[model samples]
Target: MARRRQAARAAPEPIRATSMWRVDQVFLTRKGQRVEVICSLVNDRSGLRNLSVIAPTEDPREAVRHAARFIAGKGNVSTARNARVRWTREQSTTLQDELVRDEQLEDDFQDEFEDMLAAVRDQMR
Candidate 1:
């Protein structure tokens, strides 16, 4: 029994590294009926909860590393603040794979702005 106990103690435990505070496995409800969605509904899953991002291009692992280093009082103080945004495994590919604009968009609002103003002004008269 001593040998068995020692062997059991020697066995390594599984490690699950994650920052997920909580995850609610929700189901679809429509017209008082519960629907078990089977297909990989990518669009439906993409949202602010765990799926949203500040800088979608940035790697969450780097942020984790930065936060860890800051928490340990080794890295720069700004490291934790700068590396604020974190993404789960579900958000990684969806964000990384998508194309994001880097340039400033042209202001075409002026075209409709005058028309809308005029219409509003006319409505008030």
Candidate 2:
């Protein structure tokens, strides 16, 4: 009877598992005329972090404005007419992996306390 009760109290799988990355901060980077995206992240249970993807032709300032708009909660990124920066969950994970492999993220940025996506979002205004 005790064993059965204990089994019922066991934690779920999601609680046991560690995350790959948490999309925290997003700011644009420029390489001369080219534009790239630097997605700051918190790499769970591993080293290295950061994502850089070439998104040229997109004005860097415009990209920041779009991201800021989403973070500011002024518009929706999901609605058909709400087109902005878009990436799938799978793609986000892939970008996290790429950044980790390249050691692009800084240790300072890895600090979970400073890397809250919510904090960044709130500051978008």
Candidate 3:
């Protein structure tokens, strides 16, 4: 019983480094769905790279719109009107693979960021 309570009280983990992509833009359909999204990122503190979205859905455009609104509201960010790129299925697959590979790299930055956040939370406690 005590162990169960303790586990329940444990803090949630921080966002993983692999999930931290600097989003460049999000494109939506007129019906309000997230059709696609584009993200700009740096893998090794070097050149900028891009990620293309390839979510399987009935209506990609609508999906894109939904994603745009969700990200904007959650992160207090907005997508540029002119930056929306029409995504091909092949390109989307490639980008998805790239994102996976890039995230596989050692997550030093994420460790630092989470450590700082944990320190702050501990201080407040």
C-alpha TM-scores of all predictions: 0.17, 0.31, 0.30
Clashes of each: 0, 0, 13
What is the per-residue lDDT of model 1 for residues 1-125, given as tens digits with 9 covering 90 to 100? 88888977766755544221211221111212221111111212242232211221233333222223223231111111111222223433676533332111101112222344455456659
Q: Model 2's lDDT to the true fold?
A: 0.42
Q: Stretches of candidate 2 above 4 Å error?
A: 1-18, 44-48, 61-125
How does candidate 2 fare on TM-score?
Answer: 0.31
For candidate 2, lDDT tens digit of each residue in 12-85? 65653444454555545555575555555454544345555665435655444343333324221111111123
Overall lDDT per candidate, in order of appearance: 0.26, 0.42, 0.40
* Cα displacement (Å) at residue 73, model 2: 22
